[model samples]
Target chain A: MANISQPSQGAWTRMLPNSAAAFHRISALLTLAILVIAFSFASPAFLSVNNTLTILLQTSVIGLLGIGMTMVIITGGIDLSVGSVLALSGTVTGMMVKAGVPVVPAMMLGVCMGAACGLFNGFVVTKMKITPFVATLGMMLIARGAALQLTGAAPISQLGEAFGVLGNGALFRVVEMGDNGFPRVIFPGIPYPAILLVVVAIVASYMLRRRAIGRHIYATGSNEEAARLSGVLVDRTKLIAYTLSGALAGVAGNVLMSRLITAQPSEGVMYELDAIAAAVIGGASLMGGVGGISGTMIGAFIIGVLRNGLNMGGVSSFIQQIVIGFVVIGAVYIDQLRNRR
Target chain B: MSQTLQAAARFDAETTPLVEMRGIEKHFGGVVAVDGVSLDLRPGEVVGVLGHNGAGKSCLMRILSGAMAPSRGEIRIAGDVVEMGSPQDARAHGVETIYQTLALADHLDAPSNLFLGRELKTRFGNLDDKRMLAEARKVLATLNPNFTNLKDPVSSLSGGQRQVIAIARAIYFDVKILIMDEPTAALGPSETAMVADLIRKLRAQGIGIFLVSHDMHDVFDLCDRVVVMNKGKLVGAHDIDEVHKDDILSLIIKGELPTDWRPRNLGELEAAR
Candidate 1:
């Protein structure tokens, strides 16, 4: 137990992702570092302490979602219902708070709402034998419609200021003072959203690397029939993957609701695509069975850093989307090329 | 205590067969895939089953391996009646199978594939990866000393190397009755020889092997007895010395022993026919 999590042997320590995947993992890391460095040079404001924290906070939402997407993709399944589930969960939490329920429990119910939507997606995909793309796509519409109906298409913006603790509220402050006792380079401190993202990332990575179910997820994705024949409960493994994905999306929704201090039914539309892009750019294959949480976090930061740098460099907002799209395609292309060689 | 019983069981193959399947039948809708048939294999014996496509060989083996439920049958392992509802149940009864597809998760490395469902875990139930690695390394070293791609995903391995991984998985756990479907169908000469060596080694260890094969050479070289099936019934069963390769082929192609065939001991063959 004392030696738990240690890499004991040499070649045996090389571990998962194989050699090519290891190369891809490192390449992704280098890509993120290069983005941060290049962006810092491209815009003088990009390297500032204030802007760096902002980039991380902006990354928190999509990065959290990407964690769940990575697990689903590892099993060769996709959860397109993430964005809608997030909106539905957030709306429920906001409504509960507005109706005088406690914030903590209301938020818990909000996250549970996301999990319930995900559970539906799982049942539809597994018990009903529907393909994940179609199943989650159906869920995507169903959750969105539910959120819209509940909110009557109006955003909930009047939640009390006491509800602000979950979003932009600082947990620990980091600030630098000038010689005249005035704050010179003020840091936003570590916000609630960033803290949530860190906790989720650590748990997700630990599960992926150290759990039996995690290994089963890889096996089920790599070759499902093989996993089934090996006595792996394939259906149950898939159910858990979707549920975890939904639970994380729930976490994301609460973070976003906290950040805005409002629940907008229209919020999180197309955010699913961003989450998938982050996982893919981090080296997860759409074909399934290849990716890591660390890579995904870096991938999210790459997107965040890229957008911020572009904004400060006076680039058109529309060009930013085009650039991110190119990066996603290029990342997959490079991975395929490595495999071919 | 159980090890002693297993050791005693290994020597008494002459008295009790390791696997006994009685009145196995499989029906698909109105069609009968396998009619009433029985098969048995003793410890330290290798039996080969041969048939053309759709002759119900695969269907029968699927039931025996716990991949499919028989419409009706009794499967007895080590002289005890057992109900095997899944591959996991079959394995618990000491029956292990290697399919033609090899059934490997191509993206995982050898150790992960070897312990797919049965993983080594710490006290907290997290995967005890270091211990699993050591165990996999130990078992694999005995199988293929030159197998060095332990860290690479199985998809990157060669076909022979992949077969080694599959075989390692089957034998790593405790096994009594081993079923192999077309072990040499996908391998070249050297790899085929490698699998042949493994078969002989398992037999020497007192494990019963049911080799489902189309290759007459593998049938002749490895099996003590050969069984042929046609139209969902046992066409013929023969000792390797008492039968010719062509006779086995004719039984597979025509589902019957040739009209002018001679039998040294007509007891088992005549009874089956």
Candidate 2:
């Protein structure tokens, strides 16, 4: 646990403590232990390799959104519009692809649509002095309306096989060693999108830990007036944060559409709460100035695993919600304890 | 007074002064802060400004540093009159002010704070961090050797180290006239001694200094001349060698030398001491 402290506090050596961060690492390990133990007792299916893959796949979409939310929260802002933006962007991409646009252009247009929405939110928050919630809430309605209007409140289906490959494809054939007659190979099957999520998480971790701009973002979040007095471009920093969050949300929505082979206007209706909760559970503070991508990834995994394990144990969907809600509350209370110390 | 004489005698270089402010006046809202105050600062000289509360010492220095616009005044730097519209204007005209807080960001280290608002950039438009770190080390070596540990964040530094960083920043920016407000206000004896040494080092570099402080001991120890202000008006200017601590106290409180103020008899004062 103490060894892992080096990575956590090395990024902000002065602001945090090595021993204090070690405690957080210990807490994370303890939670993982509890998950493994509980899941092992819940159902035999929860311990299977196939079930683990399902958990990873389920986490990928929310994990992507959580990464961007981490960055936004670190810079002292929130994007309530991300869920609606995701639906809108996915709907637009699905419509464009149905209209004979190439897969590449559709994806590009979808990403641009998300970035444009974020830009509008950024402008309102920075230029007009609107608070983050109010500004992104306004964007939430606008994007929701646009999504419904474009889809006529119906799901757009028949996204081509090539487009669906991003979410549903396995890069290589799965091989087994037993008498199932699946030829054994050096490697097993891996989802391309899952690999992509891992790559994105690694890149985000590197950028946040090793870059000067990353330091500036933390500084702005810690004390905006101090950061500005030190000549950091506060407005520009916030704009970039919000824009990146929107783009990530767009990517998540696209991944979902690619998986389902359709865009539902009702998709991602309340996913923002789940994404925010995942990030907070992972150690991000709503008050800002803390948390990272790696923590958020673990947080997403926790939620995904909980859902999968609960379902396998015959828990009802409503009960699952209640359980997750309690988990969110508990995670936040622990985070507060760590912070106060 | 004798100590001040010895300090001033060491730095007296040329007859002509470096900075001259004539009839400086400033008004804030409906109130007049500085009324017709004139001052002259010579090269390699330490000039102290003393005043009671609301006596316009800060207002006058702010005008000098271009932090504020003087309602009326004429400032001459190196015998040429100059106009100041902003703090940047003061920097362009070789004037720098070091406030009490030092204005160094706690999260940043010495090198970063040394170039805070004006960071050095590489050809690719990124921060020239390597060059900045090297230059910071060089400046610390030349100015304050104790500050060679520049890698530590400013928040971890002591009061003396923070003060040194502020002074080093002014020196790096090529400030000809340094305006320091209460440089050692909260320092202990040793820390204050270190700052006094830094002021002497700056004086040796041929920079003019306008020191605003209420400490007569520091003024008597470092300043060559002292200017006193009372009730938003200039009280009087005195060569530190020609005046005692009582004279400054009297000037600050009453806006004039105390009546019946005379040097104590040496035998009796020595017995008391």
lDDT agreement with native, every candidate: 0.86, 0.79
lDDT of 1 at A122: 83
Give the per-prediction TM-score of chain B: 0.90, 0.85
Give the per-residue lDDT digits (tens) of candidate 2, residues A81-193. Answer: 98999999899899999999998799889988888888888899899999999999999999999999988999998777878988877667565676886667544456666
Interface RMSD of each: 0.8, 4.3
Instruction: Provide C-alpha RMSD values for all models, in order.
Output: 7.6, 7.7
I-RMSD for candidate 1:
0.8
How would the docking of model 2 be graded?
incorrect
User: What DockQ number belongs to candidate 1?
Assistant: 0.71
lDDT of 1 by residue, A6-101 (tens): 544433435434477777778888888898888877777888877877887889999989999999999999999899999999999999999999
lDDT of 2 by residue, B32-68 (tens): 9999987888888899999986899988998888767
After superposition, candidate 2 runs with Cα above 4 Å error: A1-22, A175-188, A338-341, B1-182, B207-216, B224-273
